[model samples]
Target: MVQSALWDFLRGQFTRLPYPETTFTDQVVIVTGSNVGLGFEAAKHCTRLNAAKVILAVRNLDKGNAAKRAIEEATGRRGGVVEVWPLDLSSYESVKAFAQRAMRLPRLDVLLENAGIAGPPYRLAEDNESTITVNVVSTFLLGLLLLPKLRETGQRYNNTPRLPHLVIVSSGVHYFTKLPEQSAPEGKILATLNDKATANMGDRYNVSKLLEVLFTRELAARSPLPSQAGNARGKGGVIINYLNPGLCHSELARNAGLGLKFMKFLLARSTEVGSRTLVHAASAGEETHGQYLSDCKVSRVSPLVSNDTEKHGGKLHTRIWDEIVRKLEAIQPGIMQNL
Candidate 1:
């Protein structure tokens, strides 16, 4: 652990991180669902950081284009190649199509898998999985499809070493729930200390995040072994990691209804504030690779996800690896079959 004084000093330095000296200029960053909310804030920051091209990978092109214009106007800069591409995570074809398009880019610097939906009532994705479907399975599929390109960025810029990063935007709720190996009943199964009924939305969101955390650890562990001994090693192997942006009042939560949105608006931080953790995770120096960060700093995770009590404290590293792999194969048979 960093000493308290040193930690404070580091944080102070981070506040100035967005200045002219070390932004992501000349880099291509693809942020999913970047039309609004936290995604929009992230894209905005990328431009401020001088990212060469920030693609707003949104589900709706119209809204995304508007956001691109708004970001450009706000930043007082134009012609930086900020644009939008359609992406619907619930569909495998959409993810694959997006991946194929991304492959055409000369370099893919940061892939922010930030698009997600909070399951309001019980719902199923096009794949017939629960609403956690978008948060977990769909995002997983997108990342899997884009993994090769993400890794290629590292090699494409090997001389300067502008490595690629995949940031899985998770949530603080991940610590509150277990990953559902089998689907659980939807809606309000638990209660908070105040006697308020916990909504099923919380359950679905939290469980999905847990699965994401496990998947990141597993993907990083397994991807490197398949490279041929003599070929340019690590060419298609990426540093996959998870990030919890904490609670933020973004457009994603407005669909929960005005009351819910209002409550979040009162308690949640600004989108730029929320975007800080993700930006750090996406572009911090080499030491932060594969690190799980919360707030604006990397911190310890919950015991259920990172710790195993019965095995003399060895990490539960492989506890959910096989299960997720099995599910991924079933979800996207052709895309994941070989892996």
Candidate 2:
């Protein structure tokens, strides 16, 4: 296992994957956390590919404007090709408000749930661990909230040949997480994670990513699109997938200590390179739906993630999904109705 990890790390550091050349002409795309780092680079790539509108969903309006200006200047695509939208993932209200505003868009072709945090000290937001709340709960809330719009876009252009994409930014670190044991009872897993005494801050982010993987798989399984005549399964109405950017140099680790900083400097890929994986995943075909992508391909995930049949009977994924929906419903009443 250690050797496998080392090989993955080395491949991420040295692999020169090509940036995707998928065109986004006339497409409207939204990338969260777009003010800097991987998000910013992805937004830039979208503009260069000629996306009609690229919404920079960010926490800070000032920084968002700066990023917009920089992208416009770099791509020479002015006249509001890139718009700045405020989005604070830590707050449920903020996410709701942003989703409401997004409903006004003429079309939303791609929704990239890219904003996330890491390595901060243990903190609670809205009665849940900060990482869990932002990365898993709020991220899905926003994704669920936007699903109607994505589905609408697909239906509106069903004959025009289009596939609306929802891409979640996950990490390879999820492979390291082991969620609560199956014998620990049904709802205790989330409770254990929320408990301050038992929760491990260092591992919380990894666990959050694990939740994302499970959530994506369960969501795909439960929400398959209607099949055509004589076909076993139809194309997914909204293609949702998760990807790992592979230890990129970014602001995600700014709060970490010196040891992490030095290690990052030595092993991390540039944000530009890492963002390519995001673009590629966003542009990929239905074969990638509900899959965990790495190094710009559909790679093998960890056994813990892949082996749901072990001991727990295959219900682990369903139980976790139910818990997430319950928690999300508490925050955004009737939100699941949209999904």
Candidate 3:
């Protein structure tokens, strides 16, 4: 595992990820965390590709508007709309409000969940550590809340040659973390993570990414979409997948140490390069459903997920999903029913 991940990382440093060639012609897309970094570049690409409506779901309206102008000027987008809406993933109320507003949109064709934090010191938001709350809990909650809209858009645009996309920007860093919290009692994984005394801050981001991969796997198994890999793009249901943008020159590692800083200097891909992977996954075929993407293609997930002997992935995936579902249900009654 170590040798292979090292090889991929070393190769990825010099490898230029393919920029997206797929156009969004008349699609309506929402990109979270679009105010900067990978989200900013991904949103720009969507606008450049001619998405009919590109909403920058951000925490700060001013920065989002600024990014909107930057994208408009950069792309010279003629008639497509680019607007900003507030979304702070730290709070369930904020995510719920954002999802509520999204459901009212004329049609949601793509939901690019590109916002996440890494390497921050432990802190509580909504009674959990900030990273777990924002990265795993609120992230999935927002996706779950908006599932109906994505399904609705899929049916509404049945004749169109596109499927509604739910793209979560996960990380290959998940390969290094085996989710030690899996040892926690089945229903208490998040709760255990929230207890700072037992938390390992250095591994928080990686563990959160692992949770994202697990939950996406669980969601795909339970969604109305075909679980088989060969379902065509516009044939079945919403396309949900997680992505790894590689080590990138982005804001994700703002709090890392000097060793990582030096590694990033030699190994990080440009955010522009990394963001294209997000755009590529957004336009990908239905085969990507419940899959992990890297460098613009379907890639292997960590063996902890894939080497399961049990049906429906493994026990860890379902255990984490159940804990997350319970948490989400506590936050908002009946969120899982949206499926």
Candidate 4:
């Protein structure tokens, strides 16, 4: 079969375009699941630019270390500045520990909540929450936990003029799903059921992705407000932006089973091809804030996502935030204060 013209165009552009230059030099980037796939590729770009530090936050310590070594070698840096921190996005306790430890370090310049699980059969987290918790809630906790450090980075450099950026690597899947109007039920009730009960994996994943976008927009609105008011002298804007990296052949699909594997073999882009959107969002200038990016350009997201209609997009945002706060509070009474 002949490939679609759009695919051909994207393929050509993806191949000939040079990798984006080091826009994040001397910056600190924390990439969850940076040991492999698009996260690893993004981390490479950070090191190439001489980032002050790149933290490979992953659940697998060995894999994280190996990726760090590869980055250091490829960049030809004399010393290994990239280090690994163990983190599991599925459990609230694990998320708490990871965030608390990161808080003690110097302020972070960027937090890439890139780790995610896709299309796994229904599995319960330690807290018995749904896979959405792993994909969405845990990420929220991690980002919120790092807020103070991210803010401090902004505050310390507010005079210098560069804003700290947080990039959320979400998927286009959210175009088709909707968030719960209320809390996520109890325990793993939502997680234990297959997509049939909570829609399909595609729907669940899409809902999670939309949640990320809402969180980013809301966070961005609140963050810059205080600083803009001049209440804090050293305040800096914590810009949150979201991007969809398109399908790539990576462990992200390892559990998608045989059909997905075969499809990916034919249609999926390489990890490098998929990382462009992410790299751009992470390094783009101030003009790119709060935009949904794809194909290395700022483009309109699906109407279902950007829409503000109560029946569609608008209500979902409020609902997601409410659920997020509810879950976070359940996990820890006053965690939102740090955020």
Q: Give the best candidate by TM-score.
A: 3
Candidate 3 has which clashing residue pairs, if any? none
TM-score, cand. 4: 0.84
Q: In model 2, where do residues sit more than 4 Å from their true spots? A: 159-161, 180-184, 225-236, 309-312
My TM-score estimates for the predictions, one after another, are: 0.79, 0.94, 0.95, 0.84
Q: Between candidates 2 and 4, which one is better according to lDDT? A: 2
Alpha-carbon error at 296 in model 1, in Å?
2.6
lDDT of 3 by residue, 1-339 (tens): 868987876776677777687989879999999999999999999988988999999999999889989999999974548898999999889999899898899888899998988875889999789999899999999999998898888877877776888999999888898778878875888889999898999999999998999899889777746435456544438889989888889877888999999998977888898888889989998788888998778888887878651545587877888888888999999988987
Instruction: Report every candidate's CA lDDT.
Output: 0.68, 0.85, 0.86, 0.71
Predictions: Cα RMSD each:
6.3, 2.2, 2.1, 4.3
Best-to-worst lDDT order? 3, 2, 4, 1
Model 4, range 1-339, lDDT digits (tens) per residue? 023424533463444334777567668888888899999988888777778788888988988888988888888864657888999887788888988888787768888878988774656675533667777778877888787788788878776436677788887655555444234554432343333456455456666677677766666555563445567645666767788787687788676768868767877778877776677777775555666766676656555556653456565555556757777777878868865
Q: Judged by lDDT against the true structure, how good is candidate 4?
A: 0.71
- Residue 47, candidate 1: Cα error in Å is 1.5
Residue 338 of model 1, lDDT score: 29
Tens digits of lDDT, candidate 2, 1-339: 747866886777788878869988888999999999999999999999989999999999999999999999999999989999999999999999999999999988899999998875888887688898899999999999998898788777665345788999998888776765334678767777888887788788888988888888887666565452233332338788899999889999888889878988888899999999999887887778778888998987777766784656657788788889999899889988986
Write out the backbone clash pairs for model 4: 128-188, 174-206, 195-199
Candidate 2 has a TM-score of 0.94
lDDT of 1 at 189: 17
Candidate 1 residue lDDT tens string, 16-65: 22322347877899999899888898888888888889999988889999
* Window of ten residues with lowest summed lDDT in model 2: 227-236
